[model samples]
Target: MNLKTIFFTIAFLASFHIFSQNTYVFLGSYNRDKEAESIQVYQLDSEGRLTKVASTTNVINPSYLTISPNGKYIYACTDTKTPNAGSISSFEFNPKNKTLTFLNKQTSGGENPVYISVHKNGKWLVNANYTDGSVAVHPLLENGIIDSMAQNIHYSDRSIHKERQTRSHVHSAVFSPEFDVLFLPDLGADKIRSYAFDENQKKPLTETQIPFTKTDLEAGPRHFTFHPNQKFGYCIEEMSGSISVYTYKNGILQQIQRINTHADEIKEGFESSDIHISPDGKFLYASNRGKENNIAVFSISENGFLKNIGYQSTFGDHPRIFAIDESGKFLVATNVISGNVIVFKRNPITGLLQKTGTEVKMENVSCVQIKKYY
Candidate 1:
């Protein structure tokens, strides 16, 4: 074959490989009755359209969900009221049958578990407890089931505002880019605390851990997102509905900017819920609940700053969290109270979102994560 012919053949093969991958979206629903006890799954096409693939499985109050690194198991946090009595469950994911088989359940170490994220090595599972303000690290068994707690840290910093920042309320727990430090966003403390992690040797961490605190006392930081390049991080303030950008270097975050999520003249009572950066690191999206329920979009400037682009109505009330497809063509915003997941088409060039009118019926959807399988 000629030189040009060989180059064309290689390009075509690379494009074909990516197109053959099947993407799936997992929705985590909170069932207070503890009857259904499962998660919902949907299939995503190349164009980012979703089709129901599997019915809801049996799991309990899955407030947050995360997939295993090998895609063999799924983990979730059950938001229960009993103090230090919530749970984290594991399931075997069957992509062919689009079903989940129960594996095991382990104590979450705290009450009101809100978020769960797995370590990069897939050996540890981290959880954020909202009620008691703690972070738990659980180990995974060889069979892909949860084993037990590796480390459980109880935050006692009640050193901020009184109304909202009375006690330490760990809202989120995520690993740094190098996986050397684990950062926990505590809403009630108005700070994001960082701890040095040792995966090889299970050791105890001290209370003198480094922390990042917001200027406003009642800001109530909720969710945090890391840049694709791993050089920057962004945290959304739930109470004040604002975004804080920081420079992440050597497991430390230095404040860069704090931008408001709501318009200056149009603020009457709103709280932020979820915050996510685009797959390509070009845009950021955050959910605002309360009187103004909308998803605010922002363009990432050259210096890693967020420039407010626009806001799109979620078409429902209380949009807690949303997920973006792997292809970056669609975004599904989960409306917990409105009982629907509003689908929107995302423009790649402009980083703007347009409603697609593709709504999925769901009850109390709080979290979503996308997975791709052949």
Candidate 2:
């Protein structure tokens, strides 16, 4: 072959190798009968198909999962409703084998731990317990093991909803983009509470003087996501089926706008579960569970307000959680009631999702997270 032919062949091989890299998809599930593994791992191809790779048994209802910022560890909040029975488990992730090695488990400081987030620095792990209306922080050892609880805060406030908001129910604990603040959304209290986070300190978080931004009575803030610019935040209100946009500065949140997630009239039983912003920050997506069973798509304006674009059917039931891959090429929604995960191909320009014809059957799948591994 000529020198030019050799160069072209080398370039083509290099591009093909990069395109063929597989992605690791981690799933968290609610295994009530102990028949299914609580955590499972799958390999996702470039076309969005999933093939099971590894699974760990006996995790006992690991309904939510989060990976460390460095991608070295996986953290899961075990949903146990008994008083003080809830716990968080740590696992050392091996990207080579697509397996998780159990590290150690610790008390989650309350019951029914539903959500967990690791600090950007990977030194701390924070979780929310829904049943007992509490949030806890745990120190992380260098080896991916979790130390005893560093702090646990409980709430007693209640909202106007008599049946659902009878008392405080903390749903999500997330850190700001800069890691200077932490936001805990209480679904039962209708409040998005903020705390000053000092990663250098032993505890690392304390209630801010201007502690919280309260949503409308019975709004039931469940999960929140910050815009890529760090200038705005969006909270998905579970009870009201709306998204609240807020101006965020120096750890304080000021509500700016509240818009419905459903395209039609707001009806009962349309519960919103999770919210995520596209990697490019041009679009925002939220999963609606009950009667709608679809993912709402919105265009994010330069000023951070959301414009409803459209909705895409999840092709399953009760989409409790959904994740957008880092490349922005694929999206996956986990249907907890349907026991399946549906994948979609995203239109980057229009911000719409089309079913990719890729589905994986897993019993009681609740959370889906994706990471690219070479």
Candidate 3:
């Protein structure tokens, strides 16, 4: 064969080798009142089969987790420290045994760290501290472990209502698709703060900080989901159990629609929990925790509008987080109060979910995240 043909054959073989590997799921559990909590690992085979593997070798209540793009490392938020200050821990996963080893830990610079996210380039780690109303950024070492805090910012703003928006509560911070902006959702402030992501600096250039387009005086936005195409975004409100959808273009947000997650009426103490979009960009799902513990499904239009499809019971109480497998064939809901992870089969075409008999046993499971591995 000629030299060019030989090069083409080698490239095709390398691509096929990487594609044959399967995906894995990592479940981060929060043991609120207990010690010695761990990160659970599970493997997903090519046929969509799940097999539980060995748990992480550390003891920390990792309420939230963010995996690296190359699938080499995972960073978890440990929120069980004193006076309520939080910490972030790093781990190295071994696909041979499907176990993780502790690498390092650093202070998150705040309290009740609820969410963790890594930049697409795997260079920076960001977190949302719920209780202390702060955001922290850290630089990741070449070995996929956190080095230390690079920047920490305490957010302050006006609280319109006394009931829910009494103080500042930073729930989650997520990077935009282009990695040029960071969206900070503060539940207590009832607004999403947008900041320009600086490529040359460690911290965000807050001089360009801009608030949400449609502010809910007391709606309490908790989590956000970006569309697959990166043209639009949606946020779920914890105070009112509603979703605010917006169009995002050129780093600006334009309000498109706001829809309620509840079917009929919301009672006194209802609060929404988590929001996620389908892998195919055809549906959106949000969890509601109140007298009724259920997941509301909404169909997505090509123009990025949402329409309510139906609701399904979470099977257990207080379904705080749910994860859709990478193949979009399964949805697992983590019922925090009930200590059960209920699995459901999802119909991608119809956007309907069917409950599967499989479930996992864990104590105070707060977050579920899945990724593919060999």
Candidate 4:
């Protein structure tokens, strides 16, 4: 073939490969069936629709899941809500069939594990047990099996709230952007704990110099998200309906600002669950589960502070967890009580959402994640 013809052929193939890439939506739920369908994988199309393609029943309560850094495996929190029966399960993901094959599991080190986070190197994983108020670490095998629990740390502290903050409840253990630190949010203790992580060590997570950052008196910090600039961290306070902004550096976070997620004054039973930033770093969105069934949108200032800009009603009960497509085109939320998934088209410029009329039923869905696999 001539040079001109060859060049044209190569360009066409590259374009085809880009457009043919598939996007997948993984849902973890508190499903009634422990046999299968508790953790389902769906194919998300360009037109913003979800179609289920595969599922696994090997886990009892895969309420939370984390995709490995290499995107080749999935780790889940199983046996949730069963006292002292919590476990972390592993699976090998087959991209061709869009399925997850069960690998191995290890005790989660506490009861009612709520969240799991895998390191970027894919060599270690950690989980937060909500009921027993502890954290567990496990190393992942090269072949996708989870090794025995490496270390388990239990916290003993109490916050101001007599009802909910009576004891320590570690909600999530999130890795820093560089994967050198782990931030553990303790809901019942009103603190965001920090740890220095070294995956190569026998115990990968160790307490840092500034071990924890205390939140407001009744602010039950549930989840945290970092800005793309890596200088700012946002924590969603569950009971207070607020977001705490911090300046993060070297495994330390200094509080810079605290803003309410709701439009009105803070009240009881707000139950804010999740927080995320847009890919472009211009907007932040947080899900409110109780007292308001909506998403609170904020405009992120250059100084890393947030201003409440708008709100979008989820139109379903208990929007527990939501995922923003990496492409920044869609936002999908799982409403646990209503048993449905809602898809919304995102306006890139305005950082707003509009329902796309592509809702599906997935009873008791709890957590969601979206990714594009080439």
Candidate 3 lDDT, 23-61, residue by residue in tens: 677777776543445678776543344578767645567
Query: lDDT of model 3 at residue 140?
Result: 91
Residue pairs with clashing backbones, model 2: none
Worst-scoring 10-residue span by lDDT in model 1: 204-213
Who is ahead in TM-score, 2 or 3?
2
TM-score of each: 0.91, 0.95, 0.90, 0.94
Candidate 4: give the clashing pairs. 35-57, 36-57
| Model 2, position 8: C-alpha lDDT score | 100
Ten-residue stretch with the least lDDT total in model 4:
14-23
- Listed per candidate, the RMSD to the true structure in angstroms reads 2.9, 2.1, 4.9, 2.9
Model 1 regions more than 4 Å off: 1-21, 56-58, 81-84, 159-161, 204-215
Roughly what TM-score does model 3 have, to 2 decimal places?
A: 0.90
176-226: candidate 2 lDDT, tens digit per residue: 989889899999989998899899998887777888888998889999999
lDDT per residue (tens digit) for residues 254-360 in model 1? 88899998877766575888988889999999988877789999999878899998999999989998887766788888888987888888999998998886788
Q: Backbone clashes in each candidate structure, one number apiece?
A: 4, 0, 3, 2
lDDT of each: 0.81, 0.89, 0.81, 0.88
Tell me model 3's lDDT, rounded to 2 decimals: 0.81
* Best model number under lDDT: 2
